[model samples]
Target chain A: MITSIIINGILIGLIYALLAIGLTVIFGVMRIINMFHGEAVMLGMYAAFVLFDKFGISPYISVFLTAPIFFVLGSIIYKFLIDPIPAREREITSLIITLGISFIFATSAMYIWSADYRTVTLPFSQDVMVFIKTRIGYPALISSCMSAVMIVGFYLFMSKTYMGRAIRATELDKDTASVMGVNVKWISIATFGIGVVLAAMAGGILSPIFYIYPFVGSNFVIKAFTIVVLGGMGSVTGALVGGIILGVAEALASTFLEYSMKDIMAFILFLGILLFKPSGILGGRTRL
Target chain B: MFFKILSSVLFLLLLFSQVSYGAGTFKIGCPAPMTGPGANFGEKFKKAYTMAADEINAKGGVNGTKLELVFEDTQAKPALAVSSAKKLISSDNVIALLGGWSSGVAFAVAPVALDNKTPYLLEHPALDDITRKNNDYVFRLQPTTGMYSAALEDFILKVVYPKEKKKQLTVAYIYVDNAFGQGVAKYGIIPFFKKNKDKFNLVVSESYNENAMDYKPLLLKVKNAAPDIVVLTSYLTDGILLAKQIKEVGLQAKMFTGTGAGHSMQDIYEKSGKATEKYFSSGPWHGEIKDANWKKWRSAWEKKYKYVPGEHEVEGYVAIQVLAEALKGVKSSDVVKQREELKASLKALNMKTIFGTVKFDNFDGYTNQNKAYKMTAVAQWINGKLLQVWPKEAAEREPAY
Candidate 1:
């Protein structure tokens, strides 16, 4: 029982890692918290639903559709909403603006889709593997694998590409990067877009397994933020660690205590980390 | 510009209300969650009752005066429900009202209707608290949390207990920690077993935040108790997620039971497929019933909706049917006279509906509460379809555990 719980915890941890990574990536480069990231994920879930409901497209196929559209949408959001505010007011402005965007996203989804819970039940939803008498669900396995691929792919993108180095430079110091001839504005916008793509991908991967609705994103956003903070600001690896820790903690807590009490434990752990290790697990590194 | 459009809409509503009040129409002020979180539910409610009312209107109006349903958007919020109730009472001058989806909204709006002595029949909101307050003017046609639990108990005694080959009658509750869920715990399943201590043993009781993503740990706790039955109380998404997780964790008890409403959704069988096989649940309405009227309505509804009407939406249709039957009995359009006549009609109402028979019993101080011989439809998921399997007379097939 404990082993299965641990495995389930780690599996969910990987998905949380993916979402936290997206939030961290945006914060890594732009230093502006994309409060609408959850909304972006919510859109991804709905996108999958529409494709599945109307066009008979699977979420696996819908991810391809969601990615490019979300990329363009994210870019537009950054260009118009995030960039227009002066840098001096950028942080607060973007926060409030993204909150509005989030509200619009949720309310619009509520209006258009209605508040009915939707799920894309695939063939592999219940197909499972047993190891040491522990059940491993296919949905969780496939989603965890997708998260891994995306994380590794992101790492490769950051280390190898010229544009990636420019983004890294902006992360290190924006003004200094501007002095070094890097287009910091373009880097921020691109990072925001990429961040949304990551969140959307997470949404697509989980759409088959998790229940989808208008307020679905709100469920993950707080946890995503908690993971980002637990991992430390701008620490890519921190997201992975923070997410795993949080997931495992929730799993063990729920096993021992009530399910609601598990949240209390997670929040307590969050507070403990903040009180003692404010720098985070791998904070101040500023690495992608 | 927004205000102009808003006011224009308001003006139209006001003008319509004023024009309808001119002798030839009977205004009914109702609250629906047409524009908020409860919009889908509200939409379903509006459709069901409107279909019932429209059918009556098409047949040449209810006693010469056309029934003008003035539906105000409550959005299932308590404040909105109260305001809308007030607006419907004062501005619309509706003698009777309906709608108020959530239990809290129903409870909140009930007092406003009671204060004005308007007949406010709650369509589906069911909390023990709503009826326990003893408001004579406020009436409920929906199943209470306790009733749902009792219905589950009925299934256990009728189906599981009779069929069990071994000595295993252990039960557990893995429900959401909300008013509806807790009410089910407090006034619902717990009380029945408390009386039937020899019949069943309550092994585990677990609660969680409704939106909590992880249900595995909770399932593990339920598994530890080694319960024969696991009862869940949750909303649609939570119900679906928990049921999925229950299967994913591979916890197989003798039977998995759902308290009601949230568990009775068609999407559960649709989404989970074979996972929900043999899952027992109780609902306010099941498409399969032993009545010609219900059968006709079901066929008509399915012909139009492309699916069977769920229990959640059917309550609205039933409430209105009872209300309509009561109004039709009264023969008066005058507010004071209609109100008096409506009360007498409702008090003596013995009409049949697509949902069930309508007869409010004020037994045990539950003033004007809808009563029935078999208020619950105990159903089991069989091959992705809910088959009514209890109340032997209503049973399509024997309940299989």
Candidate 2:
């Protein structure tokens, strides 16, 4: 039982880490928390559901379809809604606009789907792997692996590519990047799009692992924010580490204490960490 | 010219009065969650209410007035329910109030009925206090948590354990931490445990929020405890999530049971696939009730709605039937007198309906709780279909596993 709890904790942590990476990247460049981050996750889940419902494609394959589509949707949203406002009004304006966008997305999904809770039983949904008499869900394990791959891939893209360099430059200092001919506007839009793509990827992988509802993304949004703060708001590695810590902590708490206390304990720990660090675990590191 | 103008004004007043009073259309206010988390059931209840109203109108309206069921969307919130109830009473000028899916929503609207002296008929809420508060107008049809728990204890002792021939019983009770879930689990299990401590041991009794997306940690605990039966009290989505997780976590038990929310739903059959086979959910209203009128009504409903009857559908149909019975025999067109008459009729009524005899008995501090032996049916999922398993007379097939 102890071994299983440990394994489940790590697996849950990895998935959470993937979800947080999106929020962290978006916040890193935009400096505006996308209130609709959860809605992006919902979109990914819904995309996977549609693929399965309409075309009989596995969510595993639908992740590829959803990521690109999410990229385009995210870019379109930023261009139409977030780009119109001046920098002075961007913070509060983006918050209100994205909140409205969030409602539009959720209410649209509800209207199209009629607020029904949807779940898909994949061929491997019930598959399990046994390790030291501890059974682990293979779907969950697959999701963790997928999340890890995405995080690493995201890290590489942000570090190695020319566009990645431009994005980081803009995130550091938009005026400086503009003086260096970085096309800061395009970088901002593309970075937001990439952040959304990453969120969709995480959502697609976790779709079969959880119930799909119009409001499902909101459940993960809070956790993602916690991970962003825990890992240091803009730090890639921090999000990963924070996610693992939070997930494992929740697993242990639920196992030892009351199950309902898992989330509460996580938030308490988050507040404690913020009370001391203020900036976050790696806030002073000065590097992603 | 003055006489002609005066005569025309008199005609206008008389016409308006006839339209308002002589129309013979009695409006009944109702609130259900039509757009929020409870929309699935609320829409189903709406359809049932419409069907019942149509049927009653077809069969020569109640005392020459067609019953008009005015449904308002509560969104399953207390504040919204209270607002809708107030609007339904004042704006709509409904003679009686009916319908609510949650206890909190029902309780929110209870005051409106009490203050206005309108007959409050509830279909989904099962909280004992909704009817127990000595409110003359409030009448509930759903079996209370206490009543449901009593049935569970009776079945567990008399039929389930003996039929399985288990020397001892260990039950893992996982329920949604809401008014309905906690009320029954807290009140039901304690008394049953005290009475039969030698026979049954409650290994796990935990409550989780309804929006809970994960159950692995809780299921892991249940696996370690290794209870004989895994009993869950949850709504639709969480029920499916928990059932699937139960299989994934490999929580082995003699049998799996649920408290008539998601486990008893058609969604479970469609969504959970084979994971739900042999699972049991206890509640009132089964598709296979075998009652003659129920069969006819179910057939008519399927033909009209092109789907099987959900719990909300069944309850809506019965509550309206009860309301129609209460509304019968009003000779005057006065809405206030009609409200008083309906309340009295509902209080004194002892008649058979699809849900058994519709009678509200004032007992044990409750002013108008139906004492006509509320039968709670235990429906078991077998090969993707749910059939009544407990109360052997109502069981279409024996429960497996």
Candidate 3:
């Protein structure tokens, strides 16, 4: 039972890491919280749902389509909404602007979808694979693997690719990167685009496992934010580790204690980490 | 001077028009969660209310006055409900109120209704205290949380245990942590189990916050407990998640049932796919009532809404019909006297509607609650359809289990 719980926790944690990685990356590069991150995830879910419903495309396959489409959408948002604010006021202004965007997106989705709960029920969605008394749904297993691949791919992109290095340099010091002829504006756009793509991809993969609704984004946004804070604000690896810790802690708490104490346990761990290791497990030093 | 005179004439005309419009219609304020977790209930309520009002108006309305519904979005929050109630009573000047989708919201709105002396007909919230508070102004159509599981309890005691030939069975409960959930467990399940302690053993009783994305850990705990029957209380989103996760975790129980709410919703079956097959839910409406009006209403509702009406829609539609019936007896000239008369009329109401005979009687420490009507009807998901399976008279199909 404990083994299954831990394994389930890690599987879910990987997805959580994928969800938060976008927020952390955006914050790392632009020094602004993308309040619309969750809504982007919701939109991705809807996009996947539509493709599944209309075109009979599987959500796992739609992830490939959703990523590129959202990449373009993210670049457009960065160009119009995030680019106008001056650097000095960008952080606070971008937060408010993104929040407004979040509301608009949510309201629009509700108007379009009529607040109904939608799910992409694939043939294997309910198929359970049991190994050593541990039951894992095909959707959960597949989505977790997708999340793991994306997280690893993101890490590789950050460390190995020149564009990723440019984004990292911009995160460290935009002025220095600009002086070094990195084109900080382009890096910021690419980083924002990547962040949006990651969030959308998470939503696409999660569509089968989670209900798709306009307000569903709110359910995951808080957790994503918590993961971002718990994982040293900008560190991709921190997000990964923090998500696992929180997930495992939650699983343990809910299993041992009452189920209602799961969130309380998560927040307690969050507060403890804040109090003791304010920089988080991998907080400040690892920017990427 | 000429332009000023024309403006004065237009202003006076507008004022008189507003007054005449008010005189020709009776506005009922509806406070519902139009945009939150409970938004689906609100949407159904809106549809039911609109349908009832349209039908009523088409037949020349109550006392030759058209029924006007003033909707206020409460978001299912207590603070928001209170404000909506106050706004409805004060600014909207709605003669009566309808629709409270959550217990907390109903509790908050009940006080405002009492304070303002407005007759509030609550369609959905099932907390027992809403009526037990001795507030005459607030009347509830739905059964209290405790009564929700009555039919399910009967099915378990009579059909399930006896048919399975089990002398004793272990039960586990997973409910949303709220007034409704707690009330069901405290006032309903606990007492029933205690009454039949020799036949039942409660192994696990757990509560989780609403709108939670995951229930794997909770289900794992339940799995460890290994109860024979698992009872749940949840709204739509969490209900669907619980069903799916219960299947994913491979938690095997002889019977899985829900005390209404999301478990009774069609969305759960559709969204959860085969996970909810054979699952039972106990609620007020099962769409299989043996009555012509019920058949007519159900057909019309499904035809218009493109989905079958559930307990929420039934309660919403009936609340309107009940209020309209009460309003028919209100012949007082004064506004205050009219409200008082409406309350009296509601207390005196003993009508046979499509749902059942709705009589707001005082019993079991409850005031102005429709205790005359049978509240619980058990429905099960059989072959992708929710079919009434309990209460032999109302049963559309036999219990699969």
Candidate 4:
């Protein structure tokens, strides 16, 4: 039981963190809510499906290609739809814009894919390894490893690059960062792009684990949003930690309680954390 | 100007000719999930139902009266299905009803058929409650989740599970959290497993959201448990998704099974590739059999639709055959008489179908008649082909998986 709980908790938490990372990054810099964040994930799955079905490209390799493409598409969307709104009025406008984008992407996904669930299967797809008393799946291990690498790469990119610092500054205070010549608007757009890239990467890695459909992210997005908020919006590390914690909690609850109570546990944890530490565990105190 | 006048006269004559066609015409209402999440199945159902109706009409119109197929898309929602059923009854004044690929929609609209006193022929929805209740009008071709599961238990115990069954084969059962899934798990798998507890171990039984994308943890838990067999019952996407993940994670068992005929679809193998090659599943619908009636239906279906029928299509087609048989036996377009005749005929009638004999017992809603399924078949995806692996009398090929 202990082995099962630990193994289940870690693997589930890793994937959860991978999915929520994008939402956190976008929330960090954009200030405007990207309601279509889940659509990005869904689109990424579609992209992976197309690449595999049409070009015979493995999802593992397609992530690198799809990520940049989705990132650019995200940037273009931000430019045309999200950027024009005034900073003071950006939140509401962007909400409507992203929601509209989400619907369009979902509908477009249906048109292209036809709502059939697809998967990318390869050799060694059913390989399992045993260590100690706990058994682990090879594909799950690989996805967690990939997710960890990408999360670290995102951390370094944010901490070690000039554009990264500008993005961070904008996230801190767009008006102040603009006064300091940080190009806050461009940084916001680029940040949105980066967020999409993360989502695409996660999608590519996780597609084999989940079915590819137009509304694939419909259920996960709400949880992603909840995780992002629980992580204290705008905190990358917070998102990662929050997602993992949520996943672990849900897994444990499912093991102990009825499976119906799993989602309820996640919300209860959120409310509990909010009561104890309103700003979140890693969400630094700030004036919103 | 003369040609135009003649064409107008011809068109008016055609319209006038059909105006008197309703005197002996029978109205059959179709409630399907045409435009929503389950649209593909619904569309297939519509095609099959229409094709069946055309065949019946071509055969002198069921006692010299034409059969009119009235269709309404339920959008796979309960509220929409209820309203659609109402519309079909009130507006179309349909003598009888057909089509319901979704269980929730069927359950929601079942009352409408009762209220309107129209015999509702349920095609594909497998919820146990549809026939379990005391209803004279509702008739279903496909058995409930319980029937499928019961047949599966018999198949596994008798055929799949070896004579010297291991006493400690840990089993993890995961299913979608819905009426179909709940019904299958609660009434089918659990009871059978409980009776055979000494033969195998029941490790864990869990339910997951149908729309969940990340199932790594669930897979991980199953992995750690080292279950010998994993029984899964989910919709198309999640079913395939679970199979793919199970393969990628290298989870292996003596057998992996599904409750219904969902795994028999081309998409399951097409999407998951060799991952599901060796899996054995039981479904009430399979085409690779040698029943004369099935052969006729197959030839006609191929010639008409140009694609081989899936399980859903077969069930849909058989449902039409049932409705046609009932309507033909009744010889009346009156809704009340049609309902009575359809119900009586369904109970007493027998269909030699692709899945062999389909006969209903009494109207017990929990299961189909007293004996739930008309027929159950065990099939396997061996070498990229769905082969009938059980009921040796109908067995076309040996199980390769």
DockQ of each: 0.54, 0.56, 0.78, 0.33
A96 in model 2: Cα distance from truth in Å? 2.0
Q: How well is candidate 1 docked (DockQ)?
A: 0.54
Better of 3 and 4 by DockQ: 3
Among the numbered candidates, top lDDT falls to 3
lDDT of 4 at B63: 75
DockQ, 0 to 1 scale, candidate 3: 0.78
Off by over 4 Å in 3: B1-14
Clashing residue pairs, candidate 1? Answer: none
lDDT by residue for model 4 (A175-221), tens: 99999998877887788898888887888888766667676666668
Off by over 4 Å in 2: B1-24, B163-167, B329-337
In order of appearance, the predictions have TM-scores of: 0.89, 0.93, 0.97, 0.84
Candidate 1 segments exceeding 4 Å error: A50-65, A107-116, A274-279, A285-288, B1-30, B34-39, B70-96, B115-118, B328-350
lDDT of 3 by residue, A185-213 (tens): 87888889888998888899899999988
Q: Which candidate leads in TM-score? A: 3
